[model samples]
Structures are given as structure tokens and as C-alpha cells.
Target: MTSSAVDPVRLAGERRRIFLALFSALAIALHALEFLLPSPVPWFRLGFANIFALLALFLYDGRAAWSVNMVRIVVASLFLGTFFSPRFFLSLSGGILATLAMTTSRKLGCEKIGPVGVSVLGACGHSVGQLLCAWWLIVRHDGVWFLLPPLLLIALVTGIINGFVADALLQRLRRHPPFEDIADGAHSDV
Candidate 1:
């Protein structure tokens, strides 16, 4: 059989698996590194691991991105030994919400808005998830509504930073020869 006639299904599946594995590893590394960074707010994370999420969203389909995101959160929690804590559940809720929001946005043709917009939207969703969980499970305090402004401001700032970082990395990767080859299916594995 001619090389051009080779089955594309197998090749596509291989590429997807490779991409998933690479992004998963990157997410784990970022999550681990976040533990080393000193932060004043206990729940306030730099979201360094989100870079991988954004990358996966841009590179692969939404389903793939969401799957990778879920895996990342579960695996990271296990690695950090926080699998059964309130923080873990809060993280799970926020992560799932954020992923769904991003995936929906992408499906709605919002991908043209780029990484910054996507990150901003994801951050807002994440904050909402966290607030809902806190209100329902932890605080049960109506006064907690007062914290919205500050929390939103923080989310906006961090989201922009994360977005810019993801955008820059995506651009850089696009320019790399190896990534170009992968994109072109010249390399079977990501």
C-alpha cells in the first residue's frame, strides 16, 4: 500500500495519547512546583498548572482538554497528600467548573478571543465554584459575600498573567521546529 494511503485513525489516536501524556506530565510538574512558591493567601494559588490546561485546549479538542484537566487535579491532589481534605474537594469543584466553562466557551466559537479571554473566563468560573463550595460546606456565612470584590480583582490579575504566559508559550511552541513537525503529523508522538 502507498504511504499516503496508510490508515489515519491509528496515527490520530497515537498523536492524541502522546499529547495527553505530555500535558499531564507538564501539569504534574507545575502543580508540584507551586508548592515551593510562598503565598500569603492559603487558597490563593498562582495557577501555574493552568498553562497546560490552556495549551491543551488550544492544541487538542475540548474533550481532550477537559479529560487532561480532571486527571491533573486528581493526580496532583494525591501527590500533595491532600486527597481527602476540604481543599481537595474545593479544588475538584473549581477545576471541573473551570474546565466546563472553558470547553463551552471554545465550543461557542470564543476561541478567537485568544488565551487571555479564555483564562479570564476560566478564573471567574473557578472563583464562583470556590465561593459556592465555601458557602455551602465551610463558612455558611452570608457576610462572605463581602469578599467578592477583592477575590474577583485577584482573579482578574492572575488570570491575565496566566493568559499571557500561556499565549507566549503557545507562540513559542508554534515556532519550534519539533512542534511544527508534530503539528504536520511528521512526528507520530507529541
Candidate 2:
């Protein structure tokens, strides 16, 4: 007979890593899917993958949410062959700002704020970040600034859609058996 002892901390870390990898993959898939869809403008994106970031923020901690988002952005860029390109930088900037905004808003405990509010904040941050990156790295034109109003309008509409979808997904996951463990683990970390 043989007995082996497993370190609880190590096991938890492994579990976290696995879960984060899965989240990143899901984000990447969503990102790719969004790319396959049609947009009004070349730079416009629905940011559907942000749902995973919201999930990480609401379920896990800010660090985990950041990890998921960064990994997703990097992997998605690599897969799409956009690594190190101007677009890649824009995406990275947007992801960083969105994650920061969402996490900070949650910490601030905004009045009557829910996932929807947080999502909208993140979306707005993302749009601004991308616009700044474009103006600095690509556009370098004063007229580019005019894009802000329209971009913000697009962000508002898409944010509402993303937030509602994320809320619905969260509710369903909470009831599902296989995903229930993930929901539980996420709460325990908080």
C-alpha cells in the first residue's frame, strides 16, 4: 500500500490556473467570433469577449480578472496573426483600461451599480483607450478626435448588450452543476 499527501495550496493554485486558462480560451473564442461578424466601421468591435472579464471580476478577484483579460488578449492576438501590430497595441490598451475601470468601479461601490453599470464603465474606458492609442500611434490627426462621440455611442449600445448577456450567463451558470463548482470557488477567493 502506498499513500501520498497532496498540498492543498498547490492543488488550489493548479485549479486556479486551469480555470484561468479555460476563461482565456473562452475569451479568445469570443474575440475571434466577433471578428467574423460585420461592423459599421473598420475599428469598431462589439467586445463580446468582455463577458469573461466581467465574470472574472464578479466571481474571482481583480488580479484574476486581469490575468484572464491579458492572457486572452495576447493569445487572441497571436492566433489572429496581429501580434506586435498597431491593432494589437490598441487591443492591449483597451483591455488594460477596461479591466482597471471595471475593477475600480466595483471597489468604489457606485450607487445602484450592478454588472450592467460596471460593464458600461469598462466599455467606455476601452473605447477611450483605443481611440487614444489610434490617435497617438496611427491617426495623429486632430480630426481623429471627432470619432470620440460616435465611438462612445457605439460603446454605450454594445455595453448594454454585453452586460445583459453576461448577467444572463451568470445566472445560468449559477444554476448549472458543472459550473456551480466554479462559481463556488470564485466566491471563496473573495
lDDT (tens digit, per residue) of candidate 2 on 1-190 = 1213766556556666777788889999999888778877977999889988887777666788899899989988999899999989999998998999988887676435677888999999999999889888997977887988998898898889988988887787668543444543234443
User: Which parts of model 1 have CA positions greater than 4 angstroms off?
Assistant: 1-6, 176-190
Which candidate number maximizes lDDT? 2
Lowest summed lDDT over 10 consecutive residues: which window, candidate 2? 181-190
lDDT of 1 by residue, 14-70 (tens): 666887889888998888778668878766777778778888787666777787788
Q: Evaluate model 2: give its TM-score.
A: 0.85
Native-vs-model 2 lDDT? 0.81
